[model samples]
Target chain A: MRVRKLIYLLWATAVFLAACGGSGKMEVTNAWGRTSPAAAANGAFYMTITNNTGQDDKLLSASAAACATVELHEMYMRENDVMGMRQVPDGYIPLPKGQTVELKVGGLHVMCINKQQEFMIGDTIPLTLQFEKAGTMEVTAEIRDSAEMPANMPGMQHGGG
Target chain B: MKQLLPLFAFLLLLLAACQSEPKYYGTLWPNPQEVADFTLTGTAGPVSLSDYAGKVVLLYFGYTFCPDVCPGTLADLGYVVRELGRDADKVQVLMITVDPERDTPEQLAEYMSHFHPSFVGLSGTEAEIAAIAAEYGVFYQRHEGTAATGYLVDHTARVFVIDQQGKYWLSFPFGMMREQMKADLQNVLRRG
Candidate 1:
């Protein structure tokens, strides 16, 4: 009976990991980048990072050959009704154990500054993300336009899409 | 149980009625009040708020150098104006730059054209712009940046809507969806 119980627990753990799309130490999914608007030189990239490991992980930095520089930044609402954005000063994004962090539009994102090439639709942007515990993981973010962005984020109520 | 069914139906109807009330995504002002008139330099020449007396004006505050929020707001406005279709003719978009020191009238105009050909960009002296912003309750402050990253400005992001009668009608918060804006604009056009 004890062996059977242990087997059941292991199966349940597998099911939970599968449900969360977490395979190993860290899983990055739904990675995408936005094409710059007309005449704009800079663009942004977004993705979801799920920490599946037992230990907490920190995203130290990111790099891409497509841009001169890549920085982790956050878009936050400031006082006096201002919308503010700046590079994360500490230079690391935290991913706690078993937590999923989303880097999306109008929130946390990767700033692709002074691009060497244009980010067009259907293009795949190769990015190397460095994590403290998980080490370096390469990701490819699909380039999409603003119209293709999902509006289902909480508190986003725009009509006439 | 049979009698309770009517009570439940009545309660559901009341809930539906409450939800049916015309909902506005933006902050609804109590009444339409005269917008503080101001004159600023446009691409062509001097422009005044009163010049758009018969049109609905959507005003946004930001700079051309803003990579994210400003552009996002402009894109939202473009979506709104384009969604309005023919009624778009009656709607005007004006982007007032907070960084007038660098954003000349010509630069503002050129940037506005990239978003929408009909969009107008306005700029003025630092004091002039400050006065206008203060009157509209917009607070802005500059944040210095390193050599690689240029300086940034933190300013109000709400879109103020001026009705056709040239009165301040409503103020839409940042992230207010395009569909709600379209509906409000349609209602305004219909009323006009």
Candidate 2:
């Protein structure tokens, strides 16, 4: 009877631990490359980051071997006549725990300036994203053709053809 | 008799010069073709190709966030529109947003004003933009990656011209000179 009671307690404790786990862990996805190599000199990168650890974490910055400079940028519309995209000097992107923040086209993106290397189809570029609390994470992004869509992540939207 | 012969020879020379002028004498490599019709939400209201009937239309497809091509092309369009003068009203310039999700009708209206007051910006659902792009034989795709931000899109860089009857007329290559575009526009207007 005591052994059975102990087993029940262990199960309850496991459930509690799972429920109390933080929701602010950072996850990155959906990176791609532009088609024209020369045009790739000033290319952009995109992905969705989800923070599940329940703690707010900021995206500090990004580094890549392919470019001399990397910047965070967001596109904004001004009046009824013009649209502009500018660099975000603040290296960090804030994410509330459990919520997903998306950096997409016509929105926020990572701009690779004066790329040192050309990205071709089937090639891969290494990207390292520094986060405030979660430290830094590395990802290898596949260079896709200009017409290929990012796999999964159906909620994402694309503009311009 | 000699004086009469000289007069006849001069008249013949004038006639020959006039006849030697060809019916058309412009570059013909960048010919126009038909583009598919698609619906999108315009700055003023919902717009379709049919709505701009009887006018020469300069159509460009781009997203607001594009740092280089979008603004550069619009600036060029602004110059062309200004050069049109009194005929500007007869020519409709349409800027279609490829990034419709973020570029709402309100956003499009604001974005259009930066280039020119007469420029019309349009956006709509994914399917709507896709259908229109397909009709024009435009190709685009979203790039996925491992950055903290989402993906970017790569698309064809071509401008389309439509005649008064709403038929595809011609295509301008990327970075087409303003003088050439103006000449093309004048020719289309004159033809109509």
Cα lDDT listed for each candidate:
0.79, 0.65
The digit string of per-residue lDDT tens for model 1 on A17-125 reads: 8776556579899888865443444567899998987678899889999877787888777765677777877878999988999887678888777677756668999
**Candidate maximizing lDDT:** 1
What is the C-alpha local distance difference test score of candidate 2? 0.65
On DockQ, the leading prediction is 1
Off by over 4 Å in 2: A1-161, B1-37, B145-149
Q: List the residue pairs that clash in candidate 1.
A: A157-B177, A158-B177, A158-B178, A158-B179, A159-B178, A159-B179, A160-B179
User: Lowest-scoring 10 consecutive residues by lDDT in candidate 2 chain A?
Assistant: A152-161
Which regions of candidate 1 deviate over 4 angstroms? A1-25, A38-41, A115-125, A143-161, B1-22
**Cα DockQ of the candidate 2 complex:** 0.02
Q: In candidate 2, residue A144 scores what lDDT?
A: 49
Error of 2 at A8 (Å): 97
True contacts kept of 1: 0.17
